[model samples]
Target: MKLPDPPLNQASEIAGDWPLHGLAEDMRPALAQALARGAAGLATIISLGEGGPRPVGAQMVFGMESRAGFLSGGCIEADVEAHARACMADGRPRRLVYGEGSPWPDIRLLCGARIEILVERLASDDDAARALLALAEAREPAAWISDGERRLCAPASDPAPTWPGAFSRRFDPPPRLVVFGGDPTALAVASLGAQSGFSTTLVRPKGPIAPPPLAGVAYRRDDVAGAVAAVGLDAWTAVAVCGHDEEVDHEALLAALPSAASYVGLLGARRRLGARLDRLRAAGVAETDLQKLRAPIGLDLGGKAPFEVAVAIIGEIMASRHGQPALARRPVSTPDGDGQAAKPPGGGKS
Candidate 1:
């Protein structure tokens, strides 16, 4: 099993929102190390994926003959590093689809979740630093992110703007999860939120009560639209209706749908879920968007309490973010002597 986190620094927690892949503002070190990848004049494309153990923008670097990203998990990095080196030398952007089995018959990843990563080699750094820095400074509305072979135009709009031309890797801006309501469950839910690697703003009628003494929690109580505007919601945010009250949760969910949050979850039992769904359907939330709200708000991990329930909810959040089935499971086991776990089934790389 992956070890429990030592305890996140309040100032440096990660997120678990959509665009999933686990990212933390604290990832500065990994990113800094990654920048040195290729060491030459190669730009970078850090493919963000929801399904992987890493954060969505958990960046790995591949330029010409070098790599710096953690290989999926420890089990997979060496091979990834070797191939990344070769790939950088090949002089062309690559869309490597790896999962199930191994790059070779001898190697393997226990879990078989196929990942499509777009690896591009470009002469960059000054350019990326410029664009990213501008975004950080709140200058430049948006910029066209180019990785030599392709151009991903990120307009200042929600969902930003990305061209899904095949790629093995790319970076994703953080996904926002705006929560409303402040109750006992509020802090626990927010606690779960912290682990998600998302930029969460705790919004209550007043503000975050006591600011919740939990790791990775941020408190910001503002009007819904104002909050979204301030935090900048986008396609990746998954708004959860955990604030308990119907009026507040309803308003918040409705407000978020117009923005780009990909998922909306409601915390309630069957009767409540049905009632809320019926009301939302009547409210013209667009069947697609309305359908996005997970009325039941969690997987059935058999936890009756709110905190336990929060865990289940986080599970569902993970599944939704990764675009996996509502019940995809990855059972872990120790690796064998040869470094191969129970091998998953898949043909060699296509």
Candidate 2:
């Protein structure tokens, strides 16, 4: 009942290995694709000790001739793949230990961390995979539970599994970005956001007849409220108002602040933020919501250039998402021997 290995010549044609530091959502599509090949297996890091590069829930999908996702930063993927192939051959689940106490003493991890992986053959009509993909498409949270053989996918709020030796993980929707602007800064933010793996959209009111020339970015010309309604803000969404127009920026902020977006930022001078906040208050935006606004948007990276600002903006958003504190009052060295304190942009593009 063993599955045959691919022909030797096909080795060069088979492609595999993608960096593993991304949302599980990124790995699920590859898993689905592998399933379509009729023979697929999954490898998951079920346990991890200190100093491991990837977290316990990291996963990789294997097809007959290809594989995707990373596990040990390239230290153990080939061996893991070999184990997955063996599991697929016998249709049996396997638990592999590497690093300390590993049966394969020669397979040492550079980080010197011990880890355990579970390899299992996945049926083409796997219900858990289907449910997980569906939930991801709907931008909802899902919980995946597995016992090395059986698997289940349910809403994140579902009760904990009582099954013995089961491993469970919760997956939240991927981060999304909605940029309200049509300027260079806006384009840069949208472009960088898309490249950085956010489901990115650029909303411009009465913008050019043609969309901005950026790949992987959805362009919307609707008014701020209409754009917000269409985008459907969620807890994982980030809104940036950088139109540089007083009225338009206010409109975007006014619409975005009341939504469920996890981050709301406005690009302007810190001094002008008071006036903007006053206008928003006059328009009935609650103080609690206003407090969430990141005025002079970005991490105070002391850059005035469009791309620089975009980096700071995206960095700040990611930091907020990851619960990291934003960098503050950093000092930048000027051409003169003296160092000048870097400050967030007061006005104008860098």
Candidate 3:
């Protein structure tokens, strides 16, 4: 797409509440909205040194009247926006440096790290922007390439960087959570997941006709298997089973265990894990898949409140998504038959 010559009138800056480290897909929606407002610019971190607050490929969209996303932890955004406005005005690409060897030495990063950001004026009909927004809406992976001026996008085959000097990024669909439960803990998890930028869906069999008061979470009143099928599990999806009903939990586990979901968690007493595993094994679940289950469902944060448990659960999911190693914990024995274990005191349900 060709750049528009001559900048439009400077519109009043309207602040935006966007995530600091939002995903590539997350930036697309705001970017589209910003483009719709006339003149807009895209600022991206093309390089980073040690101790940088955000990673490479982090982006911020600046419009004539609005801005979204963030480049730092509130240290250099104002300066970045200034440079972005200048680039928009000149219709030229600029490479900005900060922390070290920066033209503006006054703006220092608290982390004492250096970063290189590419700022360029982007047209509303830019091919890269349109492709990215369309792919994000369709929940498809895409590869983006830009050299501060020209931009290109295509369906992603291998999501790895290719071009040398230009910015290359692979955009994946946002993480998703399919939670099966309607209790307070379940509601808290679904709500927190949605707030945390996840595509969240809460499935409660025979639930109330009216949906819960949560804002971003989608409600499903179907059975576990049906809900799983309808929602469609993916490698970027997570499943949390916390119905507290034995049969319901078991059914949910059965449906989730053998799926493409990256994380599958079950909420229950640690002692009862063996019985659940045994049942799952007898039901023909592969041993490898059974090993993927995270029983007791969360990091051992020792908080019993519903929101606290939700925090632990979301923390664990984030850890998994970032490829963090699982914490060491005692293993459950593989005793045969449906052995019963005494449920412990209220710790957000057994």
**Root mean square deviation (Cα) for candidate 1:** 14.5
What TM-score goes with each of the models? Answer: 0.54, 0.85, 0.84
lDDT (tens digit, per residue) of candidate 3 on 234-322: 88899999787888888888888898899998887665777779899999999888878877787777776888879888988989888
Considering lDDT, which of the candidate structures 1 and 2 is the better prediction for this target?
2
Q: Output the better candidate (1/2) by TM-score.
A: 2
Candidate-wise lDDT, in order: 0.51, 0.78, 0.78
The clash count for each model shown is: 28, 2, 1
Assess the local accuracy of residue 80 in candidate 1 as a C-alpha lDDT between 0 and 100: 45
Writing each residue's lDDT as its tens digit, candidate 1 over 44-80 gives: 2244334566543344554443334453654344444
Alpha carbon lDDT of residue 243, candidate 1? 75
C-alpha root-mean-square deviation, each candidate: 14.5, 5.9, 5.3
Evaluated against the true structure, the overall lDDT of model 1 is: 0.51
Task: State the lDDT of candidate 2 residue by residue for 1-350, as single tens digits.
Answer: 12222212212112473544333335777877888877688888888989899988888888877677778766777777887888889998878777886755566677989888888888878898888888988998999898768899988877756477788888787779999888888899999999888989999888887988998899998787788889889999999888866778888888888889999988876556566687899999998898788766787678788899899899988888888754532221111223332376424432
Query: Which candidate tops TM-score?
Result: 2
**Candidate 1 error regions (>4 Å):** 1-69, 72-125, 132-168, 208-210, 281-284, 326-350
Residue 113 miss distance in model 2 (angstroms): 0.9
**What local lDDT score does residue 268 receive in model 1, on the 0 to 100 scale?**
56
